[model samples]
Target: MSDNDVRQFTVGPDDDGIRLDRWFKRHLPDASFNVVSRWARTGQLRVDGARVQPGDRLAAGQTLRVPPPESAVVAAPKPKAERVPLSPDQIELAQEMVIHRDAQAIVLNKPPGLATQGGTKTHDHVDGLLDALQFDGESRPKLVHRLDKDTSGALLIARTSRAAAFFAKSFSGRTAKKVYWALVVGVPDITDGMVDLPLAKQPGTGGEKMHVDEEEGQPARSRYRVIERAGNRAAWVELQPFTGRTHQLRVHMAAIGHPIVGDGKYGGQAAFLTGGVSRKMHLHARRIQIDHPDGGKIDVTADLPPHFAESIKLMGFDLSLGNAMIEDGPPPVTRADLKAKAKAHAKSVRKERRGERRSRGSRD
Candidate 1:
């Protein structure tokens, strides 16, 4: 392709519904985002003969008209980061964690204490070991969702970009269902209830902690049902979070006054327990159900980690009783739904007050 000639490309099925800028990044590596933005700004970029923004979604079979590459507008290429080689042991460890694998997805029974992704002072993580999970695929599997460092169980990985996008939509749209198991301190008075609370990053915590803030916080809701109680000491419970937030499960459990065992960050000293119980976090992603890219659905369950299993055994709780409450409930309500509900409640209150006033006037 010469620099003077305009370029045209057809969007593929796999690239459907992706942003225009992302399409550029995937197919045209030489074109930087800045160059693409410049082209869009000058009306040199068109999709199906219509000018489109960088964030515009592209449909399959649509024609994309790209202007000729201009030397003055294109930025210098960035140096590619060197790929670190994985050791044989690391590869084996990664493969061992895989509990379910298909063409589109790989679900790992992630153990406690392993970070989902690398960060400051964190060298080992599931993201780093993902290269071993790439089994003859064109690209490495991508993480669709994350589990905290001390939280164990099912973590989904997408094997292709299309699958990644599909799984991400399921999660963001709240269609994907995730069930977690935890042993919390003290049994709740209510056997089953929903915690409709908002959460925000705690001040002075450097964004590492979350706290319940009804006044200024994002909406967060969690449903919990006590499965089995070990006297008054602790209770094995099933938790389903409707909204995903930072440290949401931990923060919600702690806010309800029944912190998950070994979660010292939110629970403090009360998080730990007496006797021979392991001081490791008890929360585990027990099950995940989401629609697959090709068709059908992916419903898989992860076995408990060693410590969690041991604690369950120590508490003498029957394993069979854990999944008694697996029936699905109403979907999570949106902000609009909440507003409508509040309006209806206010109207009902006003009607009741008017009736009370009328009855009092008749008595007088």
Candidate 2:
């Protein structure tokens, strides 16, 4: 009956077709697949108020109620008051202030090139400096959501265990709306459309970079509207991602033939730095809307970073145009089309190889 009692989740359109266990793994990384599988088998995981198997394919708009055996708990830690000095790189990208803060959450105007959390390759990260950021008491802040290392925008931090769980649930359910502004190469034929594509992690080859496999990938959806177009070469766009796959927006845009301006990985030669545009990855998390735990809705807007704002200006986009210019249009190509095309291509190639074998046998 309390806030920590049981969590109910409604999958969104973007979450369709993914395995229940895989979905849970992405959302709750700490929880193992076997743990989720066991819970699903024991009636702990219910779909639309009914028990479902772990391998069950989750569809959009399906309500899942998960009753944890124990109430949410937070482990209190000793306080350490220390201000760490920022590196020269960190100081250079430090353009804005910590916007909103409460006992539960903190909103920061995160600058570009700063990883939200550290990994093997990363040394300095936003998570490492949480103690320095003025917060209440001894509770340390944890990242509720992350922005890519190259992307700049509003980043959310949860102060307590409950807040983190709540926000994570909201994001997974698609109740949390995220708006990103990106400068993309090439103007889309339609002003506005939804890109419903799937993305799968492509294993890295040798020491080369990795890629997303649209053929056998996770369902990822992004709704994008071209705000302003400078001929056919470039346009400023507003991207709204319904699903938060790794590089969802970037991959979706690239699939639609208009990669994010400075993305070298997916954009290939069309991505900026290859004569398309002279700028860093011109993407910015502009705003986010979510239902606050206390009550009411919290709509936080992060002012465009200098680079994003300047890029828009250079492209001759009027920021005041609003969504008025976004006309209704057909949705962007879906993953179904990509899969069908790949299948047909494979069939044709196989047929050609068979013909070659016949001709070689006749000559022999």
Candidate 3:
């Protein structure tokens, strides 16, 4: 292959610190791992003008250069899927999920067992049915954040790419407040408190589980209030997670001796109740508050699902409690902050800037 056939890509913020081989699989799925390593050995895989091994991690804003493929076996890139579409059936299904909608965003009371995004075995998802929420003729409604498949509740969708970017920054900046409602097997000893635990992926679960770990875990925090309890059988709890880690709430609650009801993954058999309660996971993303891309605060709430409603009714728990809007957290990093972060990230990606950081102390 000649130099004229080269292609280049800039590492995206989300892909930062990803292994080069994994990045290739994600962006260039047609390229095999053996082919990537061959390019590395032949000095054709380069990052920032220097040859890089496939094991090397890629950072945000880094320039990666790709040499021409050595084999004709590589398949041509497929045309990108046009903006999402909804069949008449999907439109009918999704129409019932829309609790709120506007020019900039759509709020869905996503049902349990429906995935927010497609996965290996998940072809049916809220992301695929977004055309139902397409306000205008253009069908570009985009998902801003994800709700766990079994956990039903509010899922926000941005109506445009500009709004998508804005909402994405809001979540990354930790300015969005999301409130979850769950029924736990056992009541917490305290009525209200915070669970400060570091979490790491549980081994041998194939990336589908989480557990508390002190040394090699990511920091996670969740504030909770036990709204009501039914004779030590179960409790209705409101949870607010400060850090958005996978399975944080489930693992945290299980670690605290009160696993969420019907959470067989983390809570084991104890999570099940004998008295005919639906075995479905009882967690719900009841409400969310985030800054709107256009203007004002986009605060929305969702109603309970069938199983959750049934459990609440049988337990005689106060259904009206804790549904009010929550106060907004710190405002999302401003546009100026985002720009500064991007600039700093780009500079840090340069090898020369590794040893050139400014002083840590304040000037004052």
Candidate 4:
């Protein structure tokens, strides 16, 4: 089609419920996001004779009307960074981690010591190797959530933009259920308990460390049930976080005086154990269950990593007993619930600050 001609296209079955902007990226790469937004603002972009925004979801049979391309109206496309090609071994490693794969999502049993995404000093990560996992998808799979570098378990990757958006909503809405298995240094006095503590990034720690702060901390909650105990020395526990916070499980366990085994960052030297227990972090994302974009639920469980499995065996605990204690939990906290809690926390902080100022004035 000529640049002077207005374009009309029908959405396909494959793109039945994808965002308008995503359709363009998949089918019309020349039409940049800026170009689409400008057309929408000018009332020239339409779907079924109705002016539509970039985020509007399109149906399979819907008609899309696009204005004629303008040379000046479209911004110059930015240069994309060159992706380093993965080595043959890297591709094999990525493929080996896949525990579940479907049309919408891929679940990988990420092993310990592998970073989810690359960073300043880190070049090798699951994100860098996603190109090998593209399979039949038009675009590279997107990461829906993250795990710590040393933590191993079920990591979900969205195969398409629509799936990515859906999975992201499930997480942000707190509808996704994640179960974790960790071996803590000591057994908790209370076998099953909730750690309802507000956490804040510790001062002078470069935002890398979190500590409990009743005064000005964000709300973080975790529930743990002791599955089995090896005397008072250590225990295997099942963990579920109601709110997602950085290093939440590790911090919450440590704060409760039962730091996760081998988590030296938060647990210090006490995190380790005697009698030939491996010093590697024993946290593993045991299972993940969430709603799928296509229809039913996507519930995947990851096998224990080598080190964690070894630790469990050394502790003389039966692996099958871990899932026997599964019990129904209260409905996951919604986004609105979190907002209300945060607002209350902010109000409390303000009241305390005001009280301190009034006390100083009275002293003066």
Candidate 5:
């Protein structure tokens, strides 16, 4: 049969009220949403063997048939005739040193500003330049994990599809560990504690931003420790995320009132260029530990990028002391300090509640 042949399936009770397009999305992972919508709109999608719209609510026990269009296979693009060489900036950023490399996977120190992979707007990415690094012949490197565009540090790439599948399963099963270093706006009340706040995507708030939601959100957990405190302005912190979510570190840090310094979108005025402090985001992926598919555990670490190092120095942190600040056990919190912080937190909470109530009253 041709690729455009119709496929039929019966919906179960759990599939009720779901849009036809969404149902198809769950069933066909590789098919784009546009393709599914087109099939529904052209009367190629049927419910009980009758034509149905893309937005039609699915019913339990309904027989669905979808005559999908022939899959369009596009040949990979060939390099242009006059290909320009990689610029010095590109070379500087892309010249990652391999920390560990085996037949299954490769770990490297990914420099800041280079994206892990190309998107709709991005053209040059680490995945595109894998051949230059002499990774497994012409086979393109697949990203096992991702760092933000501005965040620099340890990055993992799989050399083969089987290795990629193994790494993906490891991450999903929480066997992979990732640690990050950040300079937040203020010292947290607790020197070390776990933030077990659940997070969810807020509507209309564009970009990769998330918010702490008490209800209807996914569970997110992050363990944090204060590395050092600098006056009343900023504190160096180490974070270990127990769950992998987009922008989890940034959002969680902001929720705790200590937004990561130089995070313009999340930190607000704290990240602004003022009072002689440089305006570079002082966040880095410090370390990662994961089990290899070939039988051994791998530990990889990256040195702080120059900007982060400079920020730490400017804040008067002693680099010789290393990143561990709570080594000899955490110091006790004074009774007076404890009382003062409790009062401040209570006041902030009350003020926030009052504002929320006023907004709700107005809406009503």
Candidate 6:
């Protein structure tokens, strides 16, 4: 603990909505809030390479640079931390990521590069962290929706079985407002537009990609508006997906001749233009608005990741512009039309959940 060791921490889903001082307490338990305040004043702590106050809120995936107390190596691998199936480090990691929590739900500012659900090769993921996320022992939290592994932002978790069912219905009913932010490779000619292209899984991509396949594809629509532009080079865009299709935003943008910055899978090496902008994907789940189970609404926002923020700064983009946020557009359609779709979708989701539960019960 003598030599200076710099440690960088990336904000995670659960860590969203947390104050900088509280963040230090959770992660750097040794650092007192008073010391953190001093550090912030002296510019010792930074989020996304920008100095911030200890009272500032943190979003998922933002880089937090700090020198661990006592010159300790904060990033040093915890000794045998992952020895057990679920280690203390794992549980701590899960506990530290809570952005918002209540009796019925939990909202996380999921950091980029973390998988929401586990896969064959993926082990340590949000899904795997459910054990620690079970703040209440009676009911295990449930995922309301999913975000791409490389995409960071506000993700919801249901705290109870009733809440989980309600959330499922809200999402399937299309009553939720999901917004995303991304940096595209080139500036689009049109500022505001909607892509009504049908999308389907492209063959030979390991079933992990979606393509604009009008012939045999499901309805996928997205409305995008250019927030800020750096001439004809790159621009910051706000995207709203109308249909919940896999890779809908990426494919829709790419199909329109403007691939998202750092999206190598779709845009290739051209995704990056060299220099300071990191090649990491620049897509983020900026915000989501949905009705709460206990009435009212739950609105959450997540800040850009360090890489995305760097890219934005590099492009001289100002997120405080008038067009930075696109709050309300025309309603999808008449209430009657939406009601029919909601009814059908909710019924299907409930049936599916019931089937899964019954199957599990039989197995047990």
Model 3 lDDT tens row, 106-176: 88999999999998989999878876777572655888799889999999988765566577777876888
Sorted on lDDT, best first, the list reads: 1, 4, 3, 6, 5, 2
Find the candidate with the highest TM-score and give its number: 1
Q: Is candidate 4 or candidate 6 better by lDDT?
A: 4
Error of 1 at 2 (Å): 16
Ranking by TM-score: 1, 4, 3, 6, 5, 2
Backbone clashes under 3 angstroms, per model: 0, 2, 0, 0, 0, 6
Q: lDDT per residue, candidate 2, 1-364, as tens digits?
A: 4547778888865355556876776565444666677778777788987888887867778988766535223234336666577665554443244777777777888878888888888977788777655445356676778998899888887776556666777877767888888888889998878888777776754423334566877767778888878888888888888777888888888888998988887887778734434568888888877777677876778887777777777767888864422222334467998999999999999999999999999999
Candidate 3 residue 102 Cα shift, in angstroms, is 1.2
Measured by lDDT, the strongest candidate is: 1
Total clashes for model 5? 0
TM-score of 2: 0.64
Q: Give the whole-model CA lDDT for all candidates, comma-separated.
A: 0.90, 0.74, 0.84, 0.89, 0.75, 0.81
Candidate 6 per-residue lDDT, tens place, 216-240, comes to 9987889999888888888888999
**TM-score of candidate 4 to 2 decimals:** 0.74
Scored by Cα lDDT, where does model 2 land?
Answer: 0.74
Q: What is the RMSD of candidate 6?
A: 21.0
Worst 10 residues of 2 by lDDT: 322-331
lDDT tens digits, residue span 1-364, model 4: 3545878899876677778998888887678888888888888889999999998888878999987665325555679999989999999999999999999999999999999999899988999999999998898999989999999999999998778877877887778889999999888999999998999999999998999999999888889999999998999999998888899999999999999999999999999998889999999999899999999999898999988898889879999987723344556578999999999999999999999999999999
Model 5: weakest 10-residue lDDT segment is: 323-332
lDDT of 1 by residue, 10-79 (tens): 9987787778998999998788888888788888889999998998888789999998765326566889
* Model 4 global lDDT (CA atoms, 0 to 1): 0.89
Q: How many angstroms is residue 302 displaced in model 4 relative to the true structure, after the best TM-score fit?
A: 0.8
